[model samples]
Target: MSLSLIDAENTLASPVCALAGRAALRLALTILWHPQAQRIGEQFIAAAGSGDIDVNRFAPLFGGLAGNAQALGHRRIARDALRLRRHRDHGVSLLPPQSRMRVELNGAMLAGAPVRCTPEQVDAGLVIGLGGVVLLCVHWMDRLPQASAIAAVHGVGSAAIRVRELIRQVAATDLPVLLLGEAGSGKELAAQAIHQASARCRGPMVTVNLATLSETQAVAELFGADTGALARVGGGTLFLDKIGTAPQAVQAQLLRVLKTGEYRPVGARADQAARARLIGASDHDLHDGSFNQSLLRRLEALVVRLPPLRERRCDIGVLALHFMQAWSTRTGSAPELPLAFISQLCNYDWPGNVRQLGKVVQRALSAAQAGQPLAFDALVPGVAERTARVRLGQLSGQAVLDALEANGWLIRNAALALGVSRPSMYKLIGKHPAIRQIGQIAPAEIAAALAAHGGDTGRCAAALRTPSEALRRYLRRQAAGKLL
Candidate 1:
């Protein structure tokens, strides 16, 4: 479908919009890197009343940087930026530092390299932000199909990055691919990505959910009497979702096609050549003798196992932000997400994986007021308590101490790292002899820590293993006493 035809109200939530936002951000960053970048910013600020660009066609993309610039009375800057984008190659090159960092991000994402940039670095402008990096990486990796078959799969963690690398590697070949993952773990997305990245991307993609087809219906639906999926997906991709659920007879037929590159229709006298590349996905372990082992062996030529959402908790923040933006586009009202609620999201054991988390985010938005914090407990009901209980059960006294030290004694941060609530972290600390509460800390110790850290409250808090706010309050009381 043409992104230009999509309603402006809904485009922000669409994959097209997400891609456009990335493009706009990259363009803005590039302009910032240009030697005449300051002039461009001034021009955008100067031209506050230039005629609007086609909001219907270019708005989703230009609207990101251009629209924002216009809102700030810089219509000329927006217009110039758009013009520059149309002829971006004119002498523009990213600075060496930014270019090297971008290259590192690409390698980390598509080659499974260990390179990473912390948020601090991104904020300091030492490198592009993670969102920008990921978008550029995907754009480079996917190589721009006329239209993407699916939304860009979003992940930043090592597991997700490895999966992206595998998809890129496997897409270069025509061998059958097997996707193994829990339900809603993005197997279908992976299949689509493979098809879009493959040589057969120009062709059609036909999907058959085997779980929905019975034995009697499988042959007719798949191999068709006149023209089945194989016939319809000529020189393209045929994705069989829930492959483990395929009937025994259908499994044999699929094996024949995979092995000999041919398949017979339900009642055809002769077999036909199968040209479509096959991609099979399943949540089941097919090695238990129930599934066709021979067929399994054939489909396993390239295996990609999608990790569950819980295993990649590091990606939860970015994923949540994506879902929230989608929600905002759909509803036209941006809801604020509190840090505690985000911690709650990371701590919860999402049994249903990424799909479940997305649904919960939508529900939370629906239930929250325009100005209120999104209540995690109201929507999820006991998730916080259950998560806290589970996390506390797993932690010993020494484990709590180790977590606190590892996080530089930031209770909230340490709590999040250990998948427990702040209160639970304090409770665990109370039970540990090695750990001391702010109240238990002597004034002399606090004074000594402050002196050692050159009177930096933050450093003193870390050194004393106490909360900064409490330390600040204690110092305030001491100052008052000296004044009296």
Candidate 2:
């Protein structure tokens, strides 16, 4: 039986594909990146609309060199066979001779993301993973779009898309640019993208963090006759990282260079015109009554702001996939980051942002190569403890005890409520030593252990599984209540 495809939707109508990602633009981007999926999706949609599409006529969607040609397809696909079998749910029809596309999953992989089983009913915009794997249900109402040449660059989020557009717009100009964001928030990468896309794409790009260099060193590097970094960046791009940290004196010199575009090299009598365009970066807000005003004004000619990873959690899956592939290409070892790991990654509040994510991926990669599933403890040191702290604050004492008893005092099981790891759960137990003695000892004995610790929260917390600070706060609260 052939799946129907008439009067279908225009955009990504799949709930799964629409999952929290608004930056992917059109699912067509997914198809454009992987030609095989495009070809298959297109063929299946075409045949299904014809009213007599047969599953038998088409070979397996996968296998064969033509089908695996980077796995691209959809509307323009001809050779790769895409199948659609008529799915009769409970031997019933839910339509008036209407059309619908019934998609089936064959466990096709997308980067390292897990492919979810297709639901009983498939519609438009049903995306699979960050690997550009998508299932589209085309109709007469649908329109096939062209692939964006620039969309192929780094990000797959809406914010990233805008940033890329800005880069492309400004890359042709010679104006100085300022990038503002948190550390490891892709400012440097954006700068490089700018350099590569600019008219000076053929020239060299050099980066130096002013924060890393001494005041004297930074002056020598930037203005001291354009000898070292200045000489190296000769006719290309000079990326000054952590520009806010540059000394005031150096800022003044930089301002002069920006104004005149000429600096005398060390030991050189004549001044050389600065041909390299300047790109400055800062993680902190310079306008917050801190940075040098003159320098800030000069560097504020063109600005691009980057939102942190936590702000765009939707891209975490794709970023993780990209990081893994990049590492594999660099180290020549393909390490897998399954769906479970990507889910955990999305849940985390990465204070260090993408840099931290990269480091976590590296650690996980090392463990994965050795046959270890991505462990919570590997990603975080006290995952359980940190999670439990906030949750325990909300839970009543009886609720905590009930959770402990339900888990049979299994710290890891209890930690599920705490949203933490096993190690953190154990720490939670220390905060309430009575929890550790549950089922093994009587209530009287638990009190005796607490008393024997000399009301020392640290000792009692260790025996109990509580934070010493928390116990101290509790005692102070008790004392205040008594006075009241």
Candidate 3:
């Protein structure tokens, strides 16, 4: 029998009735096939029960189903239905509340909403009947192609705990917001999330890279220009990235629009309608005096600064695994990420930040595809291996001498050869035992290494990549007759 209940009329009917009906259907299927249907029903019950609600009343049916592995071919159909039912209602509710959605649309003036959470965000208890079906849709959506950028630096580790709270606050407000972070820090993604949660999500979210536009063009673009100028954007949002670089004239024009919902297009003499909200992002010189103070004041309506990757080291492994899996799928190659590779990534300074990290991972994936062993050489190349080979306890003068001799005495040429500057080279060489023993790895030897690396400091540093620094310090103590 088809189960139908009055959704709007019987407002007081509890969800328990729906649960009971689903349970009855499973029991009927179990009875028809005895042990076979019983096992399938049990699996369904267990999976469903794992979620928030109690589907345990079906346990008797499940227990009956457990032992019939044979003659159970017919049970597959029954089990499939049960699995579908359970999956739809599984876990936590992932989407923002309707009220929250409404607020985002009207209060915040957001553009369109794109689902951002993973399948894990779905809530099991809040959904029933059709809600369960929508949950499956969320799972399917998650499997679709997504943006290739890494998750925000803040999305990893302990930082994630704090960020979730921040996300709540940022999403709740409709104020003009500014995101500050180093380049490739995922500021744009965060802005999207905010827009998704805000009230204007149903509208269009237009993005313009203010950094790429000329001063005159930016003005015309931001505020609709005259007859010749681009028409003003209708009800929607405008995302201005690298607004710090927006020219002074553009800033003045932009300020006018923010102050009064009016803007003229480039080369246009007349102002036009302005209904779009503004979201600005800046990675450089945001705090410097060179940026227009008025523009800063306007954008700072609400400011959120994203932390760097080095500050959130604990998330490196998780992020690396995620990226590795993603790239593996992209390359159609099953490449496993070794724990050691992740560990090495954690120790680096990450000067280029997440962008550099993505490049490193992509290169590693490419190398693994070429049938090479997954090694640190693929990421940073040479350093981890050399460090492992040298086995230096502390960085010291003698250690420098060892590496210098290994490479031949070349100083000016050598320092330039390594990614390290001349000062760092001198510092490394002076701290080692070799400085006193052979008077250092001879500047010329260092110079030769630099030359060999083609003056690419990164490459040279990789060539001399050893944990000699630690061993050098210990050696110095021993040489000075200062025993602990």
Candidate 4:
């Protein structure tokens, strides 16, 4: 049967081409069938092709190069061919009637032509046809590994399985995306990923931290000054980070940009210039009024919330392994993550999020270089006790006295050692009579005592621990005796 143009194009559209020249050839051939799909694909390739390359130059000559250029370039092409061969070898076929049966059937059909096959023959044919379709699908599926290997050879992450759906969704739109999460949640990374997946990936991505810029500076920074020089410098994307902390005026400036795609920088009186794209990020809750409401609404066109590390604890082990491999390759060291260390990392609440995890891994690597094991203690400092906060009210008189003696009656520093603020510490020391008495002691004598004790208070106190009350009573008695 002669193939219709629609039939030809439909079969050709199954494979998405990689080589620009080959893709153009396929499109040119398809135009004979359905001009529309071919024309659309042609225009895209024409726009992408630059310099000595054009559709006319590549279309007519692609077929002479040999067995499907795609098959030759893809790594598992041989394996796919083998699988197809195997399916053909194992595939069952419909049987033709023998000569005697053919004569009997012809005589019967002459009496009443039998147009339908027997039930067994029909069932067998249906099963074989279904098997062929399934095997053909398997052949195409097998080509996926070759494409993935090609991607790997080009230095791309093999996270395609996980990120494919998200990537596709992000690419199909030009909306302003707001990435929201806690600090170190990789909002910036997500922003770039979305930008890369979008149509504007070819453009640059400019990032500015709102927290680092003051109110006046932020306005000037986002909307360039009237001078065309600053505005003309960069034109890709304006990524605003920590949008929650951006001042009210800056938020207004950004909102204006989102509305109009234009901005006039700080100190500029010139008209606003249009921008390529706007992607914003926030480590704080902008929807909760941590940021300006109007600004949030303007950017709410597309909001992507990233879960914190604590919430996605299951991904921690995989993430940790990735980090370890990356660091090891960069530093020329062997991978050193032990199961116990990974367990602690997974169990811990990553308050700082991915940033903290990366830092811990780096620290662990450094420790390993210095002859230490890659353990949790080496990775994190003060993991058990983050900090100590004390309550002086809970201490007894004796305990208070003991603390005072331990600190040598230096109330300010003593309070620090005891983990209380300076003012509360002063109050505690002021209530002790011994502390007051120590305060009254002459500075010279105290210095002398300190020198004598070599700064050991207990030793000094044991030598001169007399009560002030007794000293006063003895002086009064001695004065009365002298008067009599």
Give all candidates' CA lDDT scores: 0.58, 0.54, 0.46, 0.45
- Give me the displacement of residue 347 in model 4, in angstroms: 1.8
Top candidate, metric lDDT = 1
lDDT of 3 by residue, 348-435 (tens): 4465667777788888777766777766665676654454333233334543443344333344333322223346666676565424
Instruction: Rank the candidate models, highest lDDT first.
Output: 1, 2, 3, 4
The TM-scores of all predictions, comma-separated, are 0.53, 0.53, 0.48, 0.46
Mind giving the per-residue lDDT tens digits that candidate 2 earns over 1-484? 2212312232322222244342211212122122222232222222112222222212223211123322232333334233322222101011111122222221122211111111111221222222223332211212222122343344444455556667777687899999999998889888998898888888899998999888888878876653577777878999999999998877876787789987777678888788889999999989976677877887888998987876555355556667777788998976655644554565565668888888998888888888877786656777556545654565555545544543333343344433344565555565664554334445465466579988655456556654444445556776899899
| Better lDDT candidate (3, 4) | 3
Please tell me which model should have the higher TM-score, number 3 or number 4. Answer: 3
Q: Model 1, 1-484: lDDT tens per residue?
A: 1111113233112222244442322212211111112212111111111122211111223112223322222222222111111112211111122222222121121111112222211222211122121111111111111112234666443355567767877898999999999998989889999999999999999999999989988888899956689989999999999999999999999999999999987788988899999999999899999999999999999999998886655456557777877877887875665534544565466768889899988887776754555777777777757766765786777656555554456565455445455677778877777655678888888878888989998678777766655678888998999999
> What stretches of model 4 exceed 4 Å from their correct place?
1-164, 226-235, 386-484
Residue 199, model 3, lDDT:
74
